[model samples]
Target: MSKLSPGEVERLKNSLKEKGYKLTPQRRAIVDIIIRNEGSHLTTEELYDLVKKDCPEIGLATVYRTIQLLEDLGVICKLDLDDGCGRYELVHQEENHQHHHLICKNCGKVLEVQADLLEGLENEIESKYDFKITNHSLKFYGICSECKNIKNK
Candidate 1:
């Protein structure tokens, strides 16, 4: 989790204000936690637990609402890894880059694949089908190295 710059914080605040949402203290705390744990891909329960440690008065419902708001505002992305739980991560405002995910079947550990592996494929698809590709979610599932080693042993 990397620290967010002051400008990034202001951008988020302004975006919220434009959407008729105030940067409430609780909401700010939630954003802070998400920003601090930037790539954690945390579930609602996990986020609630972490937020509760900081603001014990916060409720699960409030966390859920805040998460929905953030997602609607494009400040965070909701990820479905086919594990029966929705995960979330901050949307990198500066880059707006999309990365793929690798989920280990045995241990359920999710790893990020940062390379832009679909650029050529996207170009071909657009040219061949005459349809534009706006976004994509690509995930690969298999046993990770550690799990493979354990199975071998």
Candidate 2:
């Protein structure tokens, strides 16, 4: 009943082993919750709330530790929306850089932009400045269509 694919589970296991850590059941439950809510951008407290539904005995400290461990192992990454809280999402294997986010200023809804819209800009900057680009994060703030529609009504 694991949310993670077998391959993903094995990969996590191997990564943990490489770091001399074991994937305990509690850790597994936490990871399952993260995978279940892939785009949630969950904060540690939010994650703990969801994880508690499955693991009533799990502590917030455990969630914090596991999150740090997973981030350290590159299984996930932290995101700061400048909203006074740090959020987290999975580190997709296929993406060279994290996808951009569009945050609604009025309603505070966050939308993901799957396309890497800055590729050309990155290339231009690299060629112009002779700099190597490793990665980048971008977030746009504006009113979403829903908010605009509501306002226009």
Candidate 3:
């Protein structure tokens, strides 16, 4: 697993301080896990399991609270892919490159659409509707190639 860089860690710590939140060990551990697994889109339970390996004393309630706090602080993003559980990924502070998701309806596999597919749409919306597009998420649901092949077989 990748580790958080010193600069990234400090940035997160500073953000917590600005919000009147102390960087406790448990909170740091959770943040570390999230940053390390940057694109994993981990759920609360998934995070809890990974965090437990480092700090077995940490409780699920604590993880949930920490996740909520991080989300509130804009340190992490909450994603709902219609998977009946909230998934999370670190907020990319540097770039505005927000990727969309393609979900397989039959097998529930999530593939990341890496391109900024809505730039034109956002520009049009802003121009026509007088709205500012700060951020957006789009999910396309369909059968993946593997699932389609299975049906053909």
Best by TM-score: 2
List CA RMSD, all candidates. 1.3, 1.7, 1.8
What's the true lDDT of residue 60 in model 3? 99
Ranking, lDDT, top scorer first? 2, 3, 1
- Which pairs clash inside model 2? none
Worst 10 residues of 2 by lDDT: 1-10
- Candidate 1 TM-score, true structure as reference: 0.94
In the range 23-79, model 3's lDDT, one tens digit per residue, is: 999999998899778778899999999999999999999999999999998878899
Candidate with top lDDT is 2
Task: Compute each candidate's TM-score over C-alphas.
Answer: 0.94, 0.95, 0.89
lDDT of 2 at 27: 96
What is the per-residue lDDT of model 1 for residues 63-98, given as tens digits with 9 covering 90 to 100? 999999999988888999998899998877664356
Q: Candidates 1 and 3: which is better by TM-score?
A: 1
Q: For candidate 2, lDDT tens digit of each residue in 1-153?
A: 226668878999999999999999999998989899988899999999999999999999999999999999988999999899989998877789988999999988999999998989999999999999998999999999999999999
- The predicted structure with the larger TM-score, 1 or 2, is 2
